[model samples]
Target: MTDFVQSARHTTEALRDLFEATPLQRNDHLSARYGAEIWLKREDLTPVRSYKLRGAFNAMRKMRAARPDLGHFVCASAGNHAQGMAYACRHFGVRGTIFMPVTTPQQKIDKTRTFGGAAIEIVLTGDYFDQTLAASQAYCRDQGAHFLSPFDDPDVIEGQASVAVEVLDQLGRAPDLVILPVGGGGLASGVTRYLRAAAPGTAFRFVEPAGGASLRAALEAGAPVTLPRINSFVDGAAVARLGTHTFDALKWADPAQVLLAPEDRICITMLEMLNVEGIVLEPAGALSVDVLPVLADEIRGKTVVCVTSGGNFDFERLPEVKERAQRYSGLKKYFILRMPQRPGALREFLNMLGPQDDITRFEYLKKSARNFGSVLIGIETKQAGQFALLAERMNEAGFAYRDITGDEALAEFLI
Candidate 1:
């Protein structure tokens, strides 16, 4: 344990060549809301807008040191890691060939290319990530280039430990609790291992995307397990399985210590941070803060640190994020309404809406009979209770409707 922390601290010190330590700021907004001393380790402020560069740079530098002839690197990433690797490759003057799924947003591809400049080549292959990964690996083997695993490698884990080392040094003490967002478990495992060794008193709670609760599964199963399905909304942290190296360090955590951040609920946190704090956060970046309400009582009066992992969010998805957040918060809804064909029927139904209710979407599906039709209605309101009131009014008026806001299957197919 002593040797491990020593190595981590050394790595943290060496990272100064690339960039200054990311700031550890106390968050006034969250502190007041939760009645706790809430601090934010703003990993999102790094040069690459994420802590990924820490590991990438560390691994690349160490590998080059061991084998000076190794000048080429290869990686498969659809997001932040690719950018990080690109930046590091440019810094080292090494050739980097990054493979990304064809479906990757052009915004991300452009950013990665810009970061690497002449040091990297971008390849777009396969519609899915798994296929892209396979292609990158084959290319790496063919060219004798080192392949960088985002989280699985020992040196990468050591690199990620730099985050924890900075947190404790900057705060001048171990926080009572450190909240982390887990993807393939690199950051969480590195941070947890460092803190456990350096400050034995510090506690931790891990957060995973609800749809990709691989850590929770690993903890319960006593080994890593692949989930059958996972929602990719939190793209940065959505991994089907925990990395073997990461799970080794994290296996000590109890299943209860892991929290699930629902994808929709994470959007609310992203909006809040952006609007209130002027901090832009990607969906994965907001996971640590998104789970705060669930730990409100437990965290009260304690010193807590939440790692905001990344901020590479593309503004193009803002509307979708807002829509999801509103739905989860009960401020918006979608339903199928049975409307009568009479001339006065539409006006009567409109009267049921409260003053704050505004119709965002309205479409007639089909006029099945001469007397009635099925209409899709979407309403946005200030409060959730208004929906119940509107439903009651509709019932009394002998109208029929079905709420489809929470129905995923129906929403994908119809909405």
Candidate 2:
């Protein structure tokens, strides 16, 4: 092995002092379903419930070794990164200042506090992460404290490479394919870099949340480019732009190898894994597995390894996840009904419902309409096909209604 690969191996060995290596398990369910030998590198089972801890711990350790007197570090993150930094700081017995967006969930804030204990101080600032990041950097520079980047630093990237090192040692051989979930490109870059040297024949597929496809954008643009907007549903992996250091490592990646997972569709995978496999995965954690159906043809009979990146999901979001999954599968729907104000109209509308359909919501929007009233209605059905039959019956009964389930603007405003 070259110097970098050898160093990564040493780093993996050193990590044993902090925590045991995560499992690389053969998932029979996924294997059977995909017609391939599918294994999951369970980074979700890491001490911080993410691979972020590896980078955080490694960066902190290297910094401490170089500057023995360095006692303070700062980082900005809204989720996993903050928790990782906190955990690392506590391990190193160093002080850390973690900046989080003002809108971060209470559960995340509490978890970070728990991980750091007295070793870290959390400063909640700015409504957006960019603002929070800037504030943290400014504080670091002004105080002459070392700043820890979530994904940009070389030491952090090297730390992440340890994941690949463990994979090789555990699997005993390189799989034909490696599927990775991408955020700012740290894990993808680190893993791919090591694998290219260690397992030259292995292929790779990178998955990114559609709303935050920074890696794909960077590959296409020949550099990192900030997206105009990002959907934060996959909060752990929804980065607006790829990191410069990460991009440098991944510059040779082919755009075709990158796949995008829709935010809504990701929820379906999350629910399926939870219900069927008893595996609770956050949206970002499920990214590598969520794209299996799309790769079924190519991966048939091949050995595929998917990295389940993180499991820091809050159970409180279960309802929202279920709702999104239902909507994506067409099992749930919402509509605006224009109803006659006259008596018996309501009963007639109720009579048109299918036996397997349940009305979950019905609210009168304009009760004072002279001849007609507008009503907002939500319906849940046993099957997606039921909606077509329901629509046909509605038409036959002369009921005027508009399906607003897939209408983004109306759904946001009304539902």
Candidate 3:
């Protein structure tokens, strides 16, 4: 057997010491919709609600085995990796220090602490991830502690290969295609390497958030490159740069096979999974499923597996998710209307809305203008066609308006 294959199987077998392999379930809803035999590798079901624990546990285990006296570990993470390492620290009975961005949601912060108990200390630093990472690395050096790189380490990558090992064992044969979400490329690199060795003929598709296409950027640059900016909505997979080690491993990937999922469009998939399939997926976790429709023709009548990476969603963001989904589906809109400051002006404008249109938000700046006032109106409709009808009615009635739903800068400033 290849050394990688043996090591991956051994790591997967050792994982039984922490938790069982995540379920590999055939998804009836997705299968029927896409006309393909679709299955989900439910990494969301892991104890950390992510596949990160696999890498975290494996790296820590190897380190401890080699250096029995090493009792302290350190890492910096904005989400899943923090929880993964915390759980591993408690399992191995070692002290760990986790550094997280100050802007991280309270739910994630609390969960990481809960996972590590007294074995880990949570440090809330830096508003940005780079700052937190630097702080953690410096602390690791000063304290002489083992630093855990979320996706850049060799042993961690080997541990993540365990996913492919379990997948092959569970499916009993190579799938026609396996869809993976790419962040720092740890999971994708590990899984593809192991699958290439084991299955030989399996195909691969990679998904990245449109605002954070690091893998695609890296492949084009012939090296890992840092993005100037990224949309953090899909926090788990929205990496600014792919790790050097991970990029080297994934450099063989075809850029054409990499698909980018828009931040707003991914919301639609999250809602569908939750409302239709009763699956709770974080934005990053929904990336694999979100692109299935785009690959509908290619995947039809074939065996496909999508890795649903994590479910550590903060319920407080549900309203925003629903709003974004509505906007993407054309079922919702926002308008800046210039309303004449005259009697019955509001009533006349309100009369232009169709029966299916419901006003969700209305704000009038009466003080900003004397003859005409600016009104911000949010409208929700039952069907996308209703929006066109509303626009027609507004135009016919001589109402001056601007649709701000698709205007990102205006939406951020006004909505």
Question: lDDT of candidate 1?
Answer: 0.95
Give the per-residue Cα lDDT of candidate 2 at 58: 88
Model 2 C-alpha lDDT versus the unseen true structure: 0.93
Which lDDT tens digits does candidate 3 get at residues 1-415? Answer: 3898899899999999999999999999889998999999999999999999999999999999999999999999989999999999999999999999999889899999999999999999999999999999999999999999889987888988888998889999999999999999999988998999999899999999999999999998999999999999999999999999999889999899999999999999999999999999999999999999999999999999999999998889999999999999999999999998889999998887888889999998464787899889999999899888778988888889999999999999889
Worst 10 residues of 1 by lDDT: 363-372
Output the lDDT of residue 114, model 1. Answer: 95
Candidate 1 ranges beyond 4 A from true positions: none
TM-score of each: 0.99, 0.98, 0.98
Candidate models: Cα lDDT each:
0.95, 0.93, 0.94
Which pairs clash in model 1?
none
Worst window of 10 by summed lDDT in candidate 3: 364-373
Q: Which prediction has more favorable TM-score, 1 or 3?
A: 1
Prediction-by-prediction clash tally: 0, 0, 0
- Per-residue lDDT of candidate 2, residues 1-415 (tens digit): 3887988888888889889999999999999998999999999999889999999988999999999999999999998999999999999999999999999999999999999999999999999999999999999999889999999988899899998998898999999999999999889988999999999999999999999999999999999999998999999999999999999999988999999999999999999999999887889999999999999999999999999999999999999999999999999999899998889998998888888999999999888889999999999999999999889888998889999988988987888
